[model samples]
Target: MTPPLALYIHLPWCRRKCPYCDFNSYPAPAAIPEARYLAALFADLDADCAFLINHRPLSPLQSIFIGGGTPNLFSPAAIAQLLNGIRQRLPCSAAIEITLEMNPGASVMAQLPAYLAAGVTRLSFGGQSFSIRSLKQLGRIHRPRHVLAAVRAAQAAGCRQINVDLMYGLPLQTLAAARADVERLLDLSPSHVSYYQLTLEPNTPFAQSPPPLPAADVSADMGEQGQQLLAAAGLQRYEISAYSRKEAQCRHNLNYWTFGDYLGIGAGAHGKLSTVSGGQVARVIRLAKWPQPTAYLAAHQSGHSQIAHQRELSAADLTLEFALNALRLTAGVDVTLFQQRTGLAAEHLSAARAGAQAAGLLDGGAAGRLVATARGLECLNDLLQHFDLS
Candidate 1:
């Protein structure tokens, strides 16, 4: 059977870049070329779909995610045009979950109804923190009041599945402050919550001139407390940084964590696809579009290839990549999924699995699943080292 497929549409323009964000995002110009960009996006998607159809059977798209610097910055008419074009080109599942990432700084309230009408079923708000001090430190443009207003607007728009992205372990963040942020988010009764620990990524401004971060122990305590608070509010921790109500998990991201196939379109988007070659051999291919918006559009207009990079994964590469994603899930994936996704036999992982289990990093349950122990989840880097195919 062909693996489930998803679509990721990246919007690389944000009002301003955050100090800690290392994503391929840039500040928008005075005017966004929405029409031309939408045309380029469909052209990029066409190329990817052609490649997939030639290599393997095309599965109905299970989900579509519109994410980026701030997709909410675009007008709803643009979003509607994009979504309509997507449906016209691809065979989308009847029950596909479509998500659009929004930021409070943008006037999301005015666009929520149009977005819903355009087939967006989920709204993910980028509300990093409720504390004004932390928001300023992070260079976020939105105030706490904006976050509240956006959530209220989404709720009033009859959006049932809402996700608020919150960050802990900010510069000079205290446990009390972190808990307060979680408490404020819980009050909104969002269907999903992404509580992330702030990390200084390489090449980011924060990495070059680091802020005064909390101590390691303090950060850990804040995470534990926040998780406890979320659990108390009936949100289950399904993945490392994600919590959701029952059946409310982000399907697009879940597909990613499970090593399912997805086609990525837009500037700096990355994609992974699996195909069976030579009758019995399975090959996994990685593709990435041009990183710059101007370059991507130029390539699209010229009918030139938008993919800046493409490579087929070796057996070892597939094994390591599969483990890298699957182990991030709290419940983990079935042992058979390793083979189904990677085309590698379970025996290929026996030695590493045994070593990890012996080291108390993996659970040795008889349920035919590969699960990480609490210790493994805490020391995830150490556990992943055991599966290093290199």
Candidate 2:
């Protein structure tokens, strides 16, 4: 059986890049070419669909995620046009979950209703933090009030599932300050909360001139405190950085963690699909579009290839990739999925699992499932390193 499919649409323009962000996002121009960009997106999607048609059957879309610099930067009408075009061209599930990422600074209050009407069932706000000092230090444009206003607007527009992104480790964040931020976010009554630690990613400004972050132990305490606070508020930790009320988990991300297939359209987007080659050997293919908007648009407009990169995963590559995503979940995946998604025998992971379990990192119970111990979750990178097939 073909795996469930999801769609990821990237919008590469942000008003400003954050100091710690290394995503493929650039500053927006005074006037965004919405029409031309939309046309390029559809063309890119069409090419991918055609390729799949010749190679493998396309699965019905289980979810759609419009992510990026800030998807809310586009006008509601532009967003509506894009979604409608996608629906016209793709076979989507009846209960498909559509999500749009919005920034509080982008006057999103006025666009919430239009987004909801455009079939966007979920809204993920990039609030980052509720502390003014932290926001400024992080080079965010929005104030704390803007976050509250945006959430209220989304709620008023009848959006039932909302997510607020929060970060715990800041340049000068105190334990109390981190707790306060979580409390403020909980007060908004968001269905989902993505609380993550701030890491100084390479190639970003923060890495060059490292900020004075809290000590390692202090940062760990902050994370623990935030998790406990959210737990008390009835939000369960579904993933390393994600907490949500019952049935409010982000399906788009869940699809990714479980190794489901997805088609990605837009500049710098990545996609994965599983297919059978040689009539019997199962293979997984990875596709990526051009990283720059101009190049991507030009390729599509000139009827040239939009793909910047494409590769079929080797057995070793597939094994490593599968473990990299699956082990991040608090509730690990069924062991059967290892073969189903990677086209490898279950024995492929036996040695790695045994080593991890012996080291007290992975749980030894759940004979048919792969579950991570609390130690495994904390030292995820170390646990995953043992799975290296090279």
Clashing residue pairs, backbone N/CA/C < 3 A, model 1? none
Model 1 over residues 104-176: C-alpha lDDT tens digits? 9656788789999999999999999999999999999999999999999999999999999999999999999
Among these predicted structures, which one has the highest lDDT?
1
Query: Candidate 1: lDDT over CA atoms?
Result: 0.92
User: Residues 200-247, candidate 2, lDDT per residue (tens digit)?
Assistant: 999999999999999999999999999999999999998999999999
Candidate 1 local lDDT, residue 363: 92
- TM-score of each predicted structure versus truth: 0.98, 0.98
Please give me the total number of clashing residue pairs in predicted model 2.
0
lDDT, candidates in the order shown: 0.92, 0.91
How does candidate 2 score on lDDT?
0.91
Off by over 4 Å in 2: 277-281
Report the lDDT of model 2 for residue 239.
Answer: 95
lDDT of 2 at 219: 97
